[model samples]
Target: MKQGVQGSPGKPVAARVPAQARPAADGGPYRERDASVRGEHTHEERPGAGQRATVQRSSVRGQILDALRTALATGELKPGEVHSAPVLGERFGVSATPVREAMQQLALEGAVEVVPNRGFRVVERGARELAELAEVRALLEVPVMLRLARTVPAERWTELRPLAEETVRAAAMGCPAGYAESDRAFHRELLALSGNEQLVRIADDLHRRAQWPPVRHGRADLVADAAEHMALLDALAVGDLDVVRGLMGEHFAGTG
Candidate 1:
C-alpha cells in the first residue's frame, strides 16, 4: 500500500493516475527520451539497450517469483518437497537462471531454503506455526481496523465494495491461489486507509507468509471467509465498531 487512493481494485495505489493510464514502471518518458537520443547517437553512446535488457531480465524474475508464490499458496509446490530450479524452469518454459534467481528470492522470504548441492526445499510449516502467524496478523491488523472503523468515513468503506466482491468471485472459483491473492488485495486496500506505509508492508508480509502453509479449507470455508470481507465492509460503512470487531476476530480465526 502507498499514499494515494486508487479508483479500482488490482491497480497500483502509489499513483493518483489510473492503472491503464499510468506510465510503465521501467519505460515511460525516460524511454521516449532514450529513443530520441538513440536516433542522434552512436551505438557506443547508447546505454538504453543494456538498461532495457536488465529490465527485461528483472521482469522475468519477478514473473517467476509470482508464479512460485502462487504455487506455494495452492500447495502445487508442496511443503517438505524439494523443487529444483531446472525442473521448475522446465515447467515454466524458462531457463534455470531466472528460476534460480526467483528461488533465491523465495529463500530470502523464508518460503524455501537452499540445499547447496540440491535446489530449494519448501519449508514445512505445521499447524502451530500457521496459528501463530494468524494470531500475529490479527494483533497487527485488528486494532488498526478498529481505529479505521471509528475514524474513516462511511463512503470510503463503500468505495471498497468492488474489492470485496472480487474476493467473493475468487472464492467461488475454488482456486486457492486466486482467493489468497484477492483476500490479500482486499486487506491491503483496507489497511492502506491508515496511511501507514510500514504497517501496511509488514502486515502484508505476514499475510503472504500465512498463505504459504497449506490448509484444509474447502471451497465452502473459502466462500465463508470471503463473505466476511463483505460483512466487514458493511459494518465499516455503517460505523458499527462492535460488528466490525467481531467480524475481524472471526475473519482471522477462520484464516488460521
Candidate 2:
C-alpha cells in the first residue's frame, strides 16, 4: 500500500499558478501571447487573408481541445459516453469544424474513438489497462528520479516545495480537474529538471490519459496520493534513494 505524509499540516506553501492561466494585467481573460515573430509585425505586415483565417481556426481548435481534455479529466465527459461535434460546438459557441478537428486529435490520443455517422465515444478504460499505463509510467520515471536523487542538489528539490503543496491543496478542494492539473504540473516540473524535454512530453501524455478515467477513490484517497508528492520531495532532498524508490513504487502502484 502507498504511504502518505503523516501528522498535522505544515506551513502553507504558496501555490504557483501556470503563467498562461494567470489573470491578465488588465483583469481580462488570460490570453496566450503569440510567440511567433509575426507578433512583432503590425496588422498590415501580418499573414495573408487566408493565412489569418487558418491561424484563427487553429487557435479555436486548440482551445476546444484543452476544454475537452479538462472535461474528460473532471468526469464531465463520462467514460462510454458519445458526444457529437455539433452539440459540443454549440456549447463552446463555435462551429462544428473546429470541434471535429479537436475530437480527431483526441481520437489519436486514445481518449476517444470515432463512431461512424454518429460521434466520438469516450474510451472506457478498464482496471487492467490503467494498470498497464501505471506500469509503463513507473518504468519510465522511476529510474530518472533515482538518477536525479543522486545528482540534483537539495536546494533544487527545495525549490519545488510550492508545487507539491499546491497538489495537496488542490486535492483537498475536491475538484478532480484542479487536482489533476496541479498533479501534472508538479511531476512535469520535477521531470523537467532533468533537462529532457522529450521525456517530459511523453510522460505528460501518459499522465493525461491516466487522468481520463473517472476517479474511483474518495477525497481521502486523493489527499493521500497528493501527500506522496511532498514525501517524494523530502526523500529526494535528503538523497535518500531507498525512500525515493519505495515511494515511487507505491505511488505508481496506487494509480493502478
- Using lDDT as the measure, which candidate wins? 2
Report lDDT (CA) for all predictions.
0.74, 0.75
Give the TM-score comparing model 2 with the true structure, all chains together: 0.77
TM-score of each: 0.79, 0.77
Tens digit of lDDT per residue, candidate 1, span 164-188?
9998998898888889888989999
State the local distance difference test value for candidate 1.
0.74
Q: lDDT of candidate 2?
A: 0.75
How many steric overlaps are in each model, in order?
A: 0, 0
In model 1, the number of clashes is 0
On a 0 to 100 scale, what is the lDDT of residue 239 in model 2? 92
